[model samples]
Target: MEVSKRFEQAINKLYNAFHNDTLHPECCKQCAVGNILDGKDSWKHLSDNHGATTLNYLGQVHQNLGRTFNGYSPIELLHIEATFLKGCGYIIPLHHKNKRPKHVTDKDVLFLGLTAVVSYLCELDKRHDVMDCTTLFNYCNVIKQVSLLS
Candidate 1:
């Protein structure tokens, strides 16, 4: 049940953001990767578009160098951002007229993003999603816990 320091810190920040009303899908500094990186918006420079999964030239250079921000590679950060935005109901590569949640202030929308981000994080670490209810089945011996790389 060991988790990497990076994963633990990222989960804690994400949990706090969800509870503190600070998880905003559109804001570079308040988004999933932002909070994961301790509220820094510099990661936005890694991509041309906010919700784009592809990296820009700078991002490619960093990735090639094996540079990591808050323990996440540049490409992982992009995927995390894209996951959050999509979960929050934004069309990919966000634009002013992009389809989005009707109510940006809705907590439900943010919750969706949080869940998606958590799943991604767990997968990144090759661990079972801690929030998954299927673990209850494992306890009952009805099925195995869905751990990653099992």
Candidate 2:
């Protein structure tokens, strides 16, 4: 398979594996951290509790395929992930500090928002229901290809 097609297939497999509710929540966390840590017990509890699903799902997309901020408190890790998701066009930029909800830091909200976006995209892909979807992925490919030409 071509590289792009292979990437799409892997993403689809990850979506299926992640959405399988039969899987334990903690198991999802373990999948997210993968070999990034020696064991599940090594992951920060807060990150596992809050951002595991998103990290687990997206971590499968890139190499190193593990929780990037597993060493930090959940809040810190969440913030870092949120900033990354926003950079990826998954959520609005975390520019307004004052408007954030209580009990939910900017990072937490961003992570949740990212989860929704990813889930929606995965579902749309499954159903063959697409609208604005192709543009984003195509745009990314274009940028990558263009950079090579320059």
Candidate 3:
């Protein structure tokens, strides 16, 4: 489907970071929103704590002002970060006290996070999931139909 220019850019950046070992859930500069914003850490100021989905005073002001970072509202950015961290197997409001993946930098671990991020992005954009396996299921259904016909 057709994607917005911002979505295209963000996906490309995220893809590169994922393959280059630069995507880290614990790091603002390397997190999902950060990568989408071209590795900028300024988005961290939107929330009081890392992995938080709620906006702080500054974030609320920006949201009220209709401010968007790289085409995403402050609320959307917070959701993206929280979704990413959750996909990476971390509890909300990231902390040393919260449960997290044993190996933060593992390729497999990052991939899981990316998958979740992509799904959320699609949902946000009102597009089909790029990583969906429903088509495979449909194919299997087709094969079953053929077998039944045979």
Candidate 4:
């Protein structure tokens, strides 16, 4: 049930960079130009652009990620993460259209739940304009620590 440190680091760094502060210039942009460019690239291609150094950039990179507090919503980031996970082959496809199926195993559910928590945090980053870095770091750290307990 424990989430890997790598996973926690990846999600927290990304979430904080996008929401808590515009630390990464490559990751964050001040205009839609970057997002438009990102949208043009496949998710796999875009993810390659992420790195620790990406967080230390000059200009705001959150804007480059297509997050605008005035126009965008947090839920959209969840959708984006879900789509990315799907692209990464983490989420299995549901067969039935209407009624829910019991095909997903417990492990799958737990994995999804953890991913959802990270995704929700990312969404929160998109909605708010200004947030304390400590708050965001603590939130991510708490969930990551809890994952270790599992």
* Top TM-score hit: 3
Q: Mark the regions of model 1 whose C-alpha exceeds 4 Å error after superposition.
A: 135-150
lDDT, candidate 4, 29-143, per-residue tens: 4111123223222221222232111222221355356554323322333244433334233432222242321432233432443344455544445443232365766788898
Model 1, range 26-66, lDDT digits (tens) per residue? 88889999899988999999999999999999999999999
Give candidate 4's error at residue 134 in angstroms.
Answer: 28
The CA lDDT of each predicted structure is 0.90, 0.37, 0.92, 0.36
- In model 4, the Cα lDDT at residue 32 comes to 19
lDDT of 3 by residue, 1-150 (tens): 678977888889999999998899999999999999988999999999999989999999999999998989999999999999999999989988999999999998898999999999988899988889979678778888999999
- Largest lDDT belongs to which candidate? 3
Clashing pairs in 1: none
| Superior by TM-score: candidate 1 or candidate 2 | 1
Model 1: ten consecutive residues of lowest lDDT: 140-149
**Model 2: which ten-residue window has the lowest total lDDT?**
21-30
Instruction: Give the clashing residue pairs of candidate 2, or none.
Output: none
Q: Ranking by TM-score, best first?
A: 3, 1, 2, 4
Error of 3 at 129 (Å): 1.1
The Cα RMSD of model 2 versus the native structure comes to 12.4
